[model samples]
Target: MYGLEQYLLSMIYHYRYWGLFTVLSFGMIGVPVPDEFIMAFSGFQTSIGHMNFVKTLFFASLGSFVGMNLSYWIGRSLGIPFLHRIAPFLHMNENKIRRAEGWFQRFGDRLIVIGYFFPGFRHFVAYFSGMSELNYARYTILSGIGALLWSTTFITLGNLLGTHWQGIIALLHRYLSRGGIILALFVGIIYLYTSNRNKAKTHEE
Candidate 1:
């Protein structure tokens, strides 16, 4: 097994619930944890009667919520300077941040809830929300909603898929990765088109 996977598996093997929480919490703070795989694995544990699904969901949700808060506070405190230094580690860059900002401006706070399914997007939007000074109460409410939904969906999926969970999840991960890339390209195209059109109108005027 890969070192990262080994570490993740070791954590759960030794500590169970706490391990789940820790991995997910670190993940939201920009650690490269395959959180869905872990959560689903936990769900598979439930199938084998090794873990309780409700408790698993609870721990996972709590961890995700806590991590989201941590990400927000980091952005709130350090702002753009922190992101500049750490963005590379988190697989982010100026263009992604700009796109996130554009989405935030166009969609408002709802993106915080909707972004959970979009992998790296949720992380960026959380940080952006912090930098933008979104109200803490609203961010928490939305974050909680997102955390619960994300946890429940994946964990439950793991339970239902049983032994085949890993294969399907790996496939799903590939699709989500491709979808994220395609979505980025699509958005970039639209942004360029709009900017060029606006410039044309400005020149005419």
Candidate 2:
């Protein structure tokens, strides 16, 4: 992974603009790429006069919007059949799907905004939002706000921390590396608790 990071960093150094766009787009599509790192790198690059902050933010946000929409369309078109096919390997059950759907329905548009901050749920929310056929205008509005917030935060962090950027980059990388593990544990706990509650309800029934 370190080598991959180095390689990507090198690419960013050489092909800066396109590299940033490609990385951001792919990351939003559920690819295991360090999108945040690219944004931060762009920030550092901008600080050093290699790139422009406004352009970097625009491209990053555009890529995110495109990638998210693609995921949303895929979920809308594929629906439950696609999910069921992948469920066994993922160990996801119908109850979990139902629960997620319920939650999405209850929260509605708010989920899209918050989901952007949640690594595991980001891609899923896009699709779920589509499945729910959420208002396109509302989804776009909420999602755009999310994209702006997330992109600006990291990019600005990179710009402000320019010279000492390495430290912040290291901190971010550590957080990203462990983020999925933490989310997995949280999801597991939620699933187990929900499952037990469901079982008890069934027994009562």
Candidate 3:
């Protein structure tokens, strides 16, 4: 993963749009790739005259929409039972699934728009939304808006930063990676803590 990030960073320094699009597409489709960093670095590249902001944003959004739709279709076709078989490996739990389903039920469709900004929630929300049999047209609309917003925001940031964009991106990559590791550790700790608590409570009962 680290090597890939370095490779991407190098690519962004050269072919900004291609690098950004590739990273975002793969990342959205559940690859352990750094999509955010790619956007930020692409923005940095723009500052240095290697990229166009509008084009970068367009391609980034397009890639995200395509990748997410693919995942949605997979989940929709395979259904929940198949998803359950792969859930553990993906760190998806029943509680998370239920929560996503609940969100879909309440929102009817808005979750797709909102979910785009929320990491860890975005990918599964699409799948669960599909499983809920959300209208394809509506899903497309909401997801498209979300993708547009996310892509525009990051790419614009890159454009604005310009030359110093690389430094900013490097710092962000370090922090984002650290943050992901911390989040993973936190989830593990919470799972263990809850399990121990439940066992104790069960004994008392």
7 in model 3: Cα distance from truth in Å?
Answer: 1.0
| Alpha-carbon runs more than 4 Å astray in model 1 | 81-108, 186-205
Q: What overall lDDT goes with each candidate model?
A: 0.82, 0.76, 0.72
TM-score of each: 0.81, 0.78, 0.70
Clashes of 2: 0
Off by over 4 Å in 3: 84-103, 163-205
- What overall lDDT, based on C-alpha atoms, would model 1 receive against the true structure? 0.82
What is the per-residue lDDT of model 2 for residues 81-106, given as tens digits with 9 covering 90 to 100? 67778878978788776765655565
Task: Estimate candidate 3's alpha-carbon lDDT, on a 0 to 1 scale.
Answer: 0.72
